[model samples]
Target: MRKIAYSLAMVLLLAACNSESTDKSTAEVQTKQEVVHMEEALLGKWRGMIEIPQSPLEIILNLKELSGSISVPAQGISDFAFESIKYNESDVAITINLGGSLIKIAGKLKNETIEGTFTQNGQSYTITLKAYTETPVTYEKLLIPVAGGELKAALEMPDKGTGELVIIHAGSGPTNKDGNTIGAGSNNSLKMIAENLAEKGIASIRFDKRGIGDNTALIKKEENLTFDLYVEDVKAIVDYAKKDDRFNEIHLLGHSEGALIMTVAAQQNDVASLISIAGIGRPADEVLMEQLSASLPPNLLVESEKALQQLKAGKKVETVSGQLQSLFRPSVQPYMISWLKYDPQHEISNVNVPIIILQGKKDIQVTEKDAENLYAANNHATVHYFDKMNHVLKDVEGDRDQNLASYYNPDLPLTNGLIEEITKFIKQ
Candidate 1:
């Protein structure tokens, strides 16, 4: 019964990603296995924990017949409503619309417990449930203006007049204000940073990227998304901080892809400083090739190079190989074309504000070399290297696989140097 429910859930997930998925038959066949008793089993409050790496994050869900909400109360995320609840055979399944991304949980009931996996963005989390405990902390739900909608953000303000704010820019994809998205394990990197910054009397605002979280419904077609949209989104937040008298200095702190976006955004805003955390220092295309060249099939790699050249030339390729579609799909080419135009090195060189470049020797994604390149362009920038940190700012020491595994480890605390460095820089 467990196997059957899991299989059906996989089909549903695939269908959601690409409606024309080959699993059309599997999706069609997955129906109500039994509705009566299963629904009753899912009622009331449920509590579970996802154990990833050294961190264990707790989850709580409250469900009625057709509705309920799921939240990670530990991280101050409470009552994110669930849109779909269904009983598939003797097994049960529930779907939650996280902004626009859908997360599905499927499992079989055993001895008054529903044991299953939470699947999103091709990442699977083992969720063992029984029921909720403890009231959660109060986190301010802020609405910052954007193109089509006000990008919702989690704002943690300092008690007194630090008179400074750091806009925390999440990496990429559907990453929410908390620095988590589908497929990637929920590490809560950005959320942790904001909370930590508050302790140091520094306020921070972290928002969901457009087409994600509160802004998920903004873009109907993926093909219509552009890199400029994100740049504008960051600018909007800066404008908000400028108007609010709570802060006099507005600084930008971006991680991974957000780091590069901040470089471009800094040019348009009167920010006090820019902090690039694990930001790439090369052209987008070059960084992309380095990441994919080793993993892609020979034939697919050849085809990808051709498509990349067209994109770099400010043209989009009509078609890409099926295997390569995940990266170079027609729907995403427009944004890719817009993104490839920026050289992180060049952008950093042009920044009018003081810059701090950080790198982790253990990060498998953007290496130490990238940080060195950024320093080369901006010789006046302050550079810090952490030998213990990984890409997500987690304290991980070891080979690539072991370090990468920390993504799922909810118990692991972020590295030590980040807060100390940022606090000193901002307060100074």
Candidate 2:
């Protein structure tokens, strides 16, 4: 579904007080001395938590002499640099620009902790930080070489090895290896899946796609991207796993758009099994039209349909309305054209390996009909539907608002029976 635009206009608006250019040389020297003293006292690693209701997110700030970076493990963000850091005698203000949204942290240094207010999009939350130390590594960070550049990935190995490895692929639209996207905050769905799988003695690998997160160097231009390129990337990952001696079996698991990608890749690569979670069964254009029809105005919906038609026919629409540009942008049209040609059912039907389809009834983005269509195309595939699960693989018992809110909550565990079913399917 076309929700928020993935491409962000990252404009860092620094609120630091600038010294007047006309200041005397003596004033400049004094300012420089003040800054050096501030850096000496504040430059170090600090750990804290943003007290988000029901989900307190842990954050780590590493301040160097001149620059600083923040890491949110729950969000799978590591060492993301701060746009600006301003400090005085007892107070510090750090600003980070994310997808055009400004996250400003204002903190006062207390006796042993930095007490702060974290504000983002008009919402403020209390935060506190103390000095931090390095911890033991639980997972291994990896970089798999592809054609253009290396793909950033993490490999999680269980304490007890099962000799089985599952390659996890994230969904569409700037989603990182952790299943979190820009502007959507973090749910850690894919990251949770990998951790849970590891607990069951399964190894897993999750990677950032070509142009997302750490792999941004892989894409020279967005217009050059294609659906087939994603499939090829999966095959490349599979090849990497095949060469490693740690695993006896390799399985591919894809969520949302990744489901369709893995489906096509499974046919070309030598994988043991395939898993699809909340994957679309129809052509992507049909699904896009259905999703937009509900949210867009009648005029915009008509234009969206026309654009989809052109893309489906292997043609590009040069003209797109301002409102629809995020979805049908000129640079992204080639990718849409490549994606629109694949029918999930048709792609799944071509897979020779064992297949399992996971669907959730409460999923607002994908319907049960999509799963049924995939099953109809390949009756041999095992299908499981969870009554309470939503699209992010989280359980929801309330109305639409609660279901949508789960998208931003990383503390929520995976829906009951989700990991169990996947584990069972893989062991079989």
Candidate 3:
């Protein structure tokens, strides 16, 4: 038997009252311990890879309350459905019967992850599985509407929930709902924030951007996407939360380019508050000039800036130098033109809701000076400069480049006081 009723009640109560203090003390360590679940925490899509000696094998497991499906993408087997799924204590026992052939996997679920031996064809392999914890709240999925179609967002609910809602907008580019992208980059920053907010009894929704991640189909036939479209997408989410009776107030937390979007959206809507993390305080063209100067060679930097100025003057540069083609390429110039119009400080000055500007001192992308400029725009706005925190909101002291390595690390937990500070503000 499992302590279903007891654990559920206790966790919910703890989430409602002592969220920040309790999570600060026990959240990180809990990952190494156990989070016993007697309910449907095990019911969702889980994707991980098995640690083979030479190479890693990818696997996907989709589980319902009692039935499930498993797949080995490399093996050319897709969706081997199974009905014999059993839950016992903290263990998930799955037996897949493929007519004459079978694969048996029994995993121990702990802290939203599963690790166990995978036995198949008289061979055992070590495997670890992490749930697609985007919507870890009631583990609920939120479908948001847009121009032509719907977008997918995950709601990470607080234990008892029924409090405040925060719509998290990730940085620019192709960052997905979980704060990750297609290629080499993987940082679950937004997901971590949602999970952290859950401990503070604050609900949050993070969704994939249009033309990215699962929302790609939403913009399949669309072209020439504008920055205001993103702001509209977020506004739609806020409107959705307004209808739901679970949240008393709605908050916006935006990182990098998202901060600008949230700021513009807040001006048009009645949001409770706004939090800007690693946000730039200048126009997109100015930020790009700074970024290019640091990364590109001196000669190439000059060429990039000259071309950017032309683009900023509402004129298109048909031919870009070879060195700057990757950045000012024709494909992304339309978006850049749309983005360069809004100056951060100017937008921040117009925002109606209270705003908090948070900048990491060690962030190479956006420095503490950016936060200062944002604060300088409105002396009344709250500002926080994290000492050793990086742009990804992780504590990384010493060298700046070495700290950037944490951005690719998916397992690193957020720095201390991040959840604590944000929670205190929203709750207050």
lDDT of 3 by residue, 153-217 (tens): 88888778857999999997767777864332577888889988888788999988876655655
- What TM-score would candidate 1 get against the native? 0.77
**All candidates' TM-scores?**
0.77, 0.78, 0.69
User: Each candidate's lDDT (Cα)?
Assistant: 0.75, 0.80, 0.73
Mind sharing the TM-score for model 2?
0.78
- Candidate order (TM-score): 2, 1, 3
Error of 1 at 225 (Å): 1.3
RMSD of each: 8.0, 7.7, 13.6
User: How would you encode candidate 1's per-residue C-alpha lDDT over 1-428 as one tens digit per residue?
Assistant: 13333333333333333433322221233322335555466667887765442234467777655556675632334565555567654476777655346678887768878788887656677878775454364456788877876777777887764888999888877667777754345787888888888888888888777665555555656678998888998898898878988889999999998999999999999999999999998898888777778898878777888888899999989876656656776778899999999889999999988889989888988989899999999865899999898988898867778887888675678898789998888876
Ten residues in a row with the worst lDDT in model 2?
10-19
